[model samples]
Target chain A: MNAIIQTNELTKTVKGKTIVKNVNLIVKKGEIYGLLGPNGAGKTTIMKMLTGLIIPTSGEIMLFGKKLAETSKEGLKRVGSIIEYPIFYDHLTAMENLRIHCEYLGFYDKRAMIQALDMVQLKGIGDKKVKDFSLGMKQRLGIARAAITKPELIVLDEPTNGLDPIGIKDMRDLIRTLNKEYGITFLLSSHILGEIEQVADRIGVIRNGQLADEVSLSDIRRQRTDYIELLTSNVQRSAFLLEHELQVSNLKIVKDNRIRIYDAGISAGQISKLLISQDIEIEEIQKHTSTLEDYFYHQIQGGDKVD
Target chain B: MIKLIELEWRKLDRKKVFGEVIIYWVILMFLPVFFLKVVFADNPAVHFGESYGAAIDLMLPIQMGFLLFGASLINHVFIEEYKNKTMALSFGYPLSRKRLVMVKVLFIALAVFFCSLISFVLAGITTYGLDQALEVIDGSPSAADLMTYVVRMIIHSFATALASLIPLFLFGIWKRAVIPTVVCAIFLMQFPNFLGLLRITLNPDLFYAILSFLGVASVYLSVKLVNRLGDL
Candidate 1:
């Protein structure tokens, strides 16, 4: 795939503290790339720099094969973004806000406004003030505004931050539609792992202020393995016995009474025998698969500061 | 640039800020005329000597106040955009930061001008009507003097309006929207007293010249400051 956005040694500093540091990112064209990180992890800061809302202290950003500079109007014209919370004039109607966006883009498409509103399921809220909108509705309106100009790339920072379950589903479906139907590439950041996993083709995990890892969702699933969770009355004793007697080195002690063995080769009967030999009674033993959330925490603990 | 201005106008219009503009015009126009007619209706001769010029002079301070208010209004526009996070959407557009600021300034300037003009015309009509009722002019007053005063009031109002833009722009960049508005209000209230002190301490003619020069200088400085601040 062709690269839609490329950053080299991208860094941003506020006061004496660094917000983003020496980070490089590559977002391919026509793909949904999710930036996953917790709040204050510099995800929004990176988006702000990418959208030109704030200047990077150092480094280079190339959008659509052109470096972003003071005169990089053409590159920006092809991009639309919401840095953090999507903000709009509360008194203005959704359509009115989208109209303003279109005007600024020099796009006078009369149909684009209605079409975008329809796409976001806000077609019926033409005249309702945005202040009266639900959080989900406002988020949809923000998405509509970004898509109204038919920008080549859309950067959304925590788009599903305040959404409910159904709202998240709708947003996920809308994002998929935009990417699949319109072929619009997206760079979205969210702490919601499930939501990101649902639509993102590739994921970039940001920890601290730096990019920890950029892995394709498919590859992550392929490489991720299931582990056996061994619950014993005395986890410490069972863990010690499993490692020493059974020679299982991949023991993860989760809680006071539970130990997870990552080695799939070790059988439950062998684990029980090993625990019994140590006078540790097994309460329950089951297999547990590693999830995206587990991977996220593991990556975070790995000292990945994408600042 | 025109497109950017149009976009700003559309956004303002959608928010019913245009309606607020109309309300401001009506208040500015009717309040002075209503008061002048009610207070001096019984004695027309002494009160009517160049009442138009007097009215125009009266508008100088009011226009100054309005201009200050207008500056605050400009700051509010950006502040609201910032608070709502809509500012990023605007900055994300293809336009340069310079063009964006220019368009916003132009939009507010036009709104101020239009409202001031409406008020001025309404005041003129009120003055003309009163003069007709009293037969004070023997006919309509010479169009030259009326036009002169109208032009002066417009210029004064415009200058005062532009002057307010400077501090508002600075405050909007430095602080938030309310800061500039409050500061402008306080300055407007104290400006007359400040001028009185200047007149007493220095040559009155020189003071006025300096004040006029400062007004012009403030406008230039504001434009420069805004450009330098770039996208916030």
Candidate 2:
């Protein structure tokens, strides 16, 4: 599988302050890739660079195996995007906005325009002026415009923004349907974890404008850590007995009196037997599995390499 | 390039722009006749000379009115797009910023040029028609008068186009200030009047040449440094 988009040591600086720095990224063809970060974490900045909205101060962008730069914009014709927010000619109707967008791309498809609007559930409102549109409608219209041409790749920055819960779900389903049915690739950016979690095939965590890690959902699931939690009144003695007697070193003390054993190589029953042999009272003992959210938290907190 | 400019036209408020152009034509079309027949009827030979050719010279100054329209276009094409962030959408297209800026400048230039030419024709007809009724001048317009009108029409059309682009670099792209852009156009249109008010004796042709150069420089800088100026 070829990578649809790749950035090598990409850096963007504005007015002597680095906004995004030394970032490397890969978005494979026919996959839904999500950029997960907190607000003001440079997610939009990186998206802007990818979509050629702003020039990168350093490094390079390669789209479809070709260099993307001032002289090399041919690849962008096959790319579609909405960065920051949906902008439109407020006085123009939805159909007019989409028509102008298509004309710029040298594309003309009235039926496809209608279909795209229909796909986003904005079918009957094509004749309505954009000035009267609600925020969610504008977002949906933005998606309709981005997907209207059926470009090879679409980059959406916070596509679910300003949307109701139902609208967010519809957006997620639309992304999935486009990816699965039309085989379109996506590069989505959002601060909402659950929103990305539901749609992204692969996740890239960003922290402080750096690519913290990138992992496929399957990879994370395969490496899911299941730990046994032991809560006791006397954690000091309980930890001592587990370490000295049971030899449990793959464990973390989460709270004052709780020990989480990550090394599942030893059965929970064996640990219980050894801890019970000691005189420490076992207040609670339960098995806990590390979720994707936990793995993401660990990756960000630990600053681990992207798997 | 034509396609890109057409796309730019589709992006604007066409009704408002059309309304503005109509208003400019109606007002400028009658301005020269009003000044020649009504205001200076008593001293027509002194101010407007013997032939209606002098009425055309007044049309030249009145044609500078389109500079304001050019500034308004700068507001619509450059400043409004930036304020609305639709410019970012254009940047994302498979077109370079230099090309995009070029298209925008040329669009405004062409619009101003076309409107100025139309204004020239309207002012000429209005002045010629009104001169018959009012008898403001002593003699009929000669072949030389018609020739001068034709030559000035082309030159002033080009002048209007260039003058419209004068605010592109400074006020349109850099500061993105709407009022400053309009003020710049007003200053360019009234430059000769300002010099006259001060009793300055410089040649009007020399002043127009200087202003034309300024307009060219503004356009050059706008295209050359578009990468820096077009940044959000």
Candidate 3:
């Protein structure tokens, strides 16, 4: 598959402080690419640079295989974006706002506008002024304007921000439908792990203005580790007993008097019984299955390179 | 470019712009007669009451009020967009920021020029009509007086349109200060009067030409430096 978006050493500096450092990212066409990072991690800044809202200090963005810059922005016509939040001429009605957007893009289709509003579930509110809209409604309206062009790519920054559960679900579904049905690629940024986990085909972990790693969701799932964890003050004796008696040799001790047993054929019940019979005090014990949350946590906290 | 200028107009609040234009028209239309009948009635140094030709002199300076109208547009088209982040939307478009700023400047200049020209005609008609009924000034308007008014109306309207943009670069786009933009307009409108009050003897044409040049320079700088100054 061809790359829809590529950034080479993308960096942005403001007021002599580096906001986004040397970062390289690639987003393939026809896939939902998620940028997972904490707040102020330069996700919006990167999106802004890609969308031509701001110029980068050092780096180049290739959109649709063309250089994205202050002057060479023809590729932006095929991209729709809402960097931080939805912005509109609050005094204008929703229809007027969308109309202005289409006119700028030189794309005019009244029926398509209606369909976009319908897709975002903002059909009947087209005639209403944007100032009267709730935050959720405004977000939906922003989505409507973005998808109204049916561009090749849509970049949404925290698309679920200020949305109810149903609205968030609707947004997620809308993104999926647009991707699946229309083949519109997406670059979505969010701090919520579950939100991205549900929608993103691939996730890029950004930490402190750096691209830590980019991996497919399936790859993370395949590498999911299942382990048995126990907290005991008498760590050395438990380690000895578990290895000598239970033949559990694949165990490792962690901080805070805790041990993680990765040995197969081991159960929390059997481990608890063994520890109790041995007169060893067990503070806590549980069988664990690592999730995307754990993967994301490790990626962010440890900045480890995952294969 | 015209399409982009039209888009700028579409982005604005039409009703509010219409209301503002109407207020400017009505006040400017009556200001010439108001000064002649009330403010300058007893003053001897002010000779706007001597004849229709003299009243044209007073009317020309009075029409500088359109500079304030230009300032208002700079607020609507430029400063307000910057404040509300709609400018970010425009930046996201395929067009460059320099082109966008150029279109906005052209829109403001064209709107101010036409509106000022219309205000001059309305003020001329209203002053003449009121003079016929109230006998505010000394003789009737001559063919020469009418000819001069028609020519100066066009020239001064164009000058006022450009002069109104004097603060656009510094106050409107750079500082994004609304109060300073309006204050700058007020100062530009009263600039000739300030020279008179200070006993300056500079020619009127020279002074207006200078103001108009400053407006053009401001516009040129705005378009040239927008890429750096236009960041949100």
Candidate 4:
């Protein structure tokens, strides 16, 4: 897989406090990579470093297979981003803001600007000054500005932030369309699991300023922990009966009170019946299938801040 | 660099700036004559002596008025951008922060410089036109008086342009405080008046040289330390 962005131990420390630890992230070409973490989890810091908004303390950033730094930012022209928030000269109209952004990249296309606005469903509202825009409208216009040049990659930090449900859905669809149709790679960060789950092909889970997991959604789905948890007063006896009498080897006693059976061939009813026959009290039996949220939670809980 | 300057211009509120500059021009142009004719007419204690030379000298101190305009540009270009988080947008662009800051300083310098030069012309014309009607002076402007006016126009305008940037390093870029930046300009403009209160006489040439030095040093430090201080 070709990586559009690769960071080697990219770290940032501000005011004697490390905000982002050694985070080695990879976003492949033509893929939507989502960065998931809680608030103050260094998600924005990482994004800021990636977009050259903040300098890294000790690390290397490779974009388009080229190193990115303060002195060498030529690769940034082919990149677009809106970090933290959608900032604009509030006094200027949406179209003027987009035009100034384009001039920076040396990408001048009036029609493309209008087309990008149209894509965000902001067609005729380009004449409206940004100061008069609501948060959602500003977010939509920000996306329009980011997508105007149709660059190779766009890094968006909380793109759907401050949007309604319909706006969120539109943002998701826009990301998917840009990825699939234009082949524009995206590195987006959001704390909303459902948002990432809907649009991201892969995810990099950040916990305490460190990347705890970088896995494809398919891999997460395949690795989903599905098991039947049987709670009982006597877990040792229940485990003994399941292992010896029922010949169920794929089971483990958990928390000194429950046994989790991973072997799906044996039903929860069958396990309960065997435990009951053995005079072991079966308090509860539940089949658990971990969703993305649960997986994210487990990942975060499993990983702590890098020392 | 020119493109970057153009971007800065587009980023600002042109209408507000133009309107503000027009007001400054109109007010400063009429001020010299107003003070000479009405405020300090033949006042014995004030001792302006009712001369055209004194009126011209008064223009030099107030021409530093553009320093306030400099503060305005700094507010728009530096402080407001930081407050609004728009500086991060510029940082995310392809250009280096140093180059971006250089453009901002140049924009402010150019705007201040040209505005001051134009202000000199307007004030000169207004003072001359009012003097002709009132005949406040004994005779018409001498060849040497015209020479002084021309020379002051060039030096004083240049000094005003540079003086306007006096706050760029301290109040404009470092403190990022709007009120301090404007107050700094006001204090710089009132330096001679403050000296007058203490009965200290300073040479005008030396004062202008110091202001010009401040402008150059401010621009140098701004570009020099952009990497250290330009972070969002």
Q: Which numbered prediction scores highest in DockQ against the true structure?
A: 3
Q: Which number leads on TM-score?
A: 3
Between candidates 1 and 3, the lDDT winner:
3
- Error (Å) of candidate 4 at residue A54 is 0.9
Candidate 1, residue B151: how far the Cα is off, in Å: 4.1
Interface RMSD of each candidate, angstroms, one decimal: 2.3, 1.3, 1.1, 1.2
lDDT of 2: 0.87
TM-score of chain A of 1: 0.83
Residue A290 miss distance in model 3 (angstroms): 2.1
What is the C-alpha lDDT profile of model 3 across B151-215, one tens digit per residue?
A: 99999999998999999999998999999999999988887778889998889999899999999
TM-score of each: 0.81, 0.91, 0.94, 0.91
Greater-lDDT candidate between 2 and 3:
3
Fraction of the true interface contacts (Cα pairs closer than 8 Å across chains) found in each model: 0.74, 0.74, 0.87, 0.91
The local lDDT score (0 to 100) that residue A189 gets in candidate 2 is 93
| Docking quality class, candidate 2 | medium
Q: What is the lDDT of residue B166 in candidate 3?
A: 97
Error of 4 at A155 (Å): 0.9
lDDT of each residue in A201-265, candidate 3, tens digit only = 99998888888889998898888778999999999999999999889979999976999999979
In candidate 3, position A136 carries an lDDT of 98
lDDT digits (tens) for residues A111-207 of candidate 1: 8888888988888777898889988888888898888888899999888867888888888888898899889999999988988888899999988
Error of 1 at B107 (Å): 1.4
